[model samples]
Target: MEKPPSYGDSNELEQPGDDRALPPATLYVAGRFVHSDDPQAPPLYELSHSVGFLSDNDRVVRLERLDYTVRQYQGTPQVSTRARHVYDLTHPTLATSPTFAYHAEATSRRSLCSFGMESFRARTLSSAKGYRVHRAARGPDHRLVGREELFTAVPARDEAVVFEWYDARGGLLARETDNGELLSLLVSAEMGPRERDALVAAWILRVWWEMARDKGLGRWDDGAECP
Candidate 1:
């Protein structure tokens, strides 16, 4: 089977300080990384980072080596996923700080995106960039009931992106955004399935305007984890 894109390598990405300056900060990605002496490479844990805000905001997230960035806009009617360019950073997780931040390229891929740090919100409102889940009815015969929703008021990180699930049985399937606006759910169906997690930000965000139209859902299986 083909591999899927992931944020496992991203959460640990942070800015690196000067070589002649102070020691870099330490980072922990639940399991993938631990503090180490080597500035070139930090310790790797399991390699799976749960997105808190990205899945909730549906924004674009980019991880460039030791640098990680998320993008969002203001006053724009169109709500979109921010984008990131893949670059080789001299400083690795072993040599970077946890609170450090760097540059981000939002419209590099397209022309409509505006770059900025993303903030996760707790509730979804009538604002310009808000997400909501609708549940009508399954009609004649639809299995599994309804879909789920991950709502956010601010749509950033550290906030509550209310994840609500609604199935036919009214089980209220659990859905939520992790640390970044990352979305996820345990969906079981015989039709097309979601291959990657919400950590697959760009692919899922870039083409969502047309509802994926002729374009595929966008996958990282094409090449190295650059995209």
Candidate 2:
């Protein structure tokens, strides 16, 4: 398969820096982000227990077990045996630090993402952009795709641009904006299955992380961690 440069190799992306250097959390994108060939509307996917079209009542991918563990399913709304992830928490025997584990049958893939106390340093960035730091992977080897970053948020607005994800080359892979009701996702192109699934999983993590922060559920001396 054709490969993209990893985030480490990409020279264009700005490294995280002082919180003051970052833009305000309520910054907004001007217009629609969806492309001509996008899956649904201009803002492609709708946010819900299942990522699909709310307008048409279409259910594509179902996310099972939204608490600590998340399972991504493709077709019917059912449990997924392919991709399983443990986000922001771990089993009793595992480490306390927030991490991600992709489990498939007998084999184990390297974590698709991870979060730690240091991840919450940037107060302006969203949890997906700030806390979950890792790459999207494909296949049994879990080969990584360039870099992944989702940051910025538009706070306290009825309709606001939240965060966006980019490829290693600085191309927009996905952007999510939210209204009072639901989050609308916009994508640049027809992405691969793994890439699409990874984006959805990242969104779920973002939502949970914010819930933990808003409720003061899992907080540390420095910042918040999802419960």
Candidate 3:
């Protein structure tokens, strides 16, 4: 397997590849779920249960059963679809088993009509490493994008855990940290809008998977709320 990105003095941040300035942007939790009012931060994305919202309170994504739909909040209505994902759970079959065998198509629109379809999958390797991620996007042919992994970081009494996604070449794409009280995300400034959307979609899928395992929810019919 390919190795993950290298971290440096800035905690788990990727070491700079060039001298170009990279602006500091941190989205701090400020609302019911994950929200940010900081001007420098990216759009305020909020999530709770099966629905999600942008800073403008526009419904951006909704999840149900095995599928989820994502709408572009700032695009033309004629083709505002941002992403569409359908999750499949396998392995041990029963929700009671903590085994992980799941996959989903987490695709993001490249334009108003075209999409960079990504195949996302997750499986458990051991108790120490909770889950492993593999995602690839297809243009004319399928190509490897990257994966998400956990790294050691400064721990806080209230902080839950930290997860980071890196591109195939070891560039940091995004990092998510959740505390019992709030959530935060540190995204790479170089990331494009479409790619960023797809990254967020991946997180949403992972979050739902985690919730299912935690609550022993065998089916979406259980309607488990976000915690």
Candidate 4:
């Protein structure tokens, strides 16, 4: 599999700084279902692209138009809007903090979930929990049933991100690692087809958002404007 781009170096892309703020750029991250060349593997959907929001000065402050591809029971392909999340950089978590609020909305009935994060840390945690699954509904009052915890975000000695997904009973479901750019996920047989698809979607969204957040923070730390 091809590795995604890294966000560490500002020289690769236009650097965003207070003195020389760049125009907003729309970068896209794609997620696709993977399988073997052999016919034995289940059919997968095509890659889906979603946009992450950047400020006028090119700082990521929100994520929008998140879409996921899913297959119907009749084997038809469908694209569904997952959720939109807005983040408050100054006080991303605390309600009383200046410009501190996190909000999310579901874009379609096909999306079985919606979420809100108190902060960036909480956003990471929620991503780790597979976006907090909920009953598919048209409104925001849906009840959350369960979630998937893939791994801890803490960096290892090698600076690699280790991941492990487990079921509610504590059975291991999947594992993978992210070393800078490349990220791989190994799904267990115990997971159902629906669950495997959901996990893959959540994993992709989380990774992309984190990268955008890192890039934005890098710019902000270098003295870019904030909300």
Candidate 5:
């Protein structure tokens, strides 16, 4: 595996080699679900479920599904699909489990505010690290929410990655090392998720990338994107 790019350099981003890219996968769909043709129409929660597929080369690799629902505020139903639970096609044992899940609930009586506030929790199932969960309470905007320790197999005597998430921020920050050598200074905060589905996907991909490296299935290359 090539050394991960220096995080200090703003131009360097972690990317995969062209020859060893993520199995040549293709996404099938990319859009939101809605109930009506009107621009202001809300999604029919009962019939609206986001679905997509990831295929490698020509073979299907996995299926993605997201169940959505409208959130209520002060007796008014919000058109925004604020609650989402994501699931990936997997073995029978894991079929019932969600690859990633996120849900936001109202915290205050003020519902029409431009920047409404709510508490959220996200969790993911990792093949390498079992299950990981993160929680954040209602707080000031841009405040530090929490930190996560990510274990990696980089042939280090004792090395691991630290990930930090912030409220109101759209990305995650990561610090990594290899064999006691500083492999990454600080991963791009800009790489974090911009939406609910993206937030879950980013975390899952981060874990899978390390797991692939540890298992010798792939090497961590600075030229490759995370998972």
Candidate 6:
């Protein structure tokens, strides 16, 4: 029931909220076989171009103390539903009412929203991944704050797209990936929430902070620390 202490040690944990400054969080997209809500189809796949939109597959539960449960989703196309939920191990009551709000869409080419993206922009920029940047879309009109950059990316094996947000430090501020594989493996054939397919993004600017604390070596644990 308890989350294994990250990777290395708990003492390395950064102060609350310190994660906001870290960059480039790595994302692993997989299906949601354990919680599929569909009556006939449960996610089941190992690798595929399956993912939900950023605005339709995500959820947020902000704690009263200013922390949060920021869960993003990732998956395969047929099972475009997955999630990443943040939890303050010390205080979990925060899951009740989230102060911040956002979502993503799974049916339409891995679309996304919030965390500084719009339905319009997300749809218009679905070709960011495998394709080279040809015609640049309109700039600086999204809802993101500070020196953040929105990137459209995709992994091999699927025809869908993924979204990522970055801060000035090149840290992966956030991400939204949906998986089609796990959706096929659901114990019960069922779909999740209405916005489930489209709402799977993550705010992880603090990924480094979490990793630093996790690996028990602040900053130094970064790849730069080795190479």
Give the per-residue lDDT digits (tens) of candidate 3, residues 1-227: 43332212114222232223434345444422333335543333433343211221222233211112345666843322222221211222334332223333332222111112222332245243223445432323242343443211122223444766665455666566765434455765565333444454455545444544455322322222223
Query: Residue 195 error for model 6, in Å?
Result: 25
Candidate 6 ranges with C-alpha deviation above 4 Å: 1-118, 123-161, 168-175, 181-227
Per lDDT, the best of the predicted structures is: 3
lDDT for 107 in candidate 5 is: 20
The per-model lDDT (C-alpha) reads 0.25, 0.33, 0.36, 0.33, 0.27, 0.25
Candidate 2 vs. true structure, TM-score = 0.38
Worst 10 residues of 1 by lDDT: 190-199
User: Can you write out model 4's per-residue Cα lDDT over 1-227, one digit (the tens) per residue?
Assistant: 42222222213322122123222221112223332223343323333232222222322232232334476756877655443221111113333342212222333222223333222222443443232222221223332222333322222223343545544455655555543333455554443333443454444444444544565322112121111
lDDT of 6 at 132: 12
Q: Is candidate 1 or candidate 6 better by TM-score?
A: 6
Report the Cα lDDT for candidate 6: 0.25
- For residue 75, model 2's alpha carbon misses the true position, in angstroms, by 23
Better of 2 and 5 by lDDT: 2
Query: In model 6, where is the ten-residue run with the lowest total lDDT?
Result: 218-227
lDDT of 2 by residue, 155-202 (tens): 322235566655545565556665533344565445543344344445
Models 1 onward score TM values of 0.19, 0.38, 0.42, 0.38, 0.20, 0.22
Better of 2 and 6 by TM-score: 2
Return the TM-score for candidate 3, rounded to 2 decimals.
0.42
Best by TM-score: 3
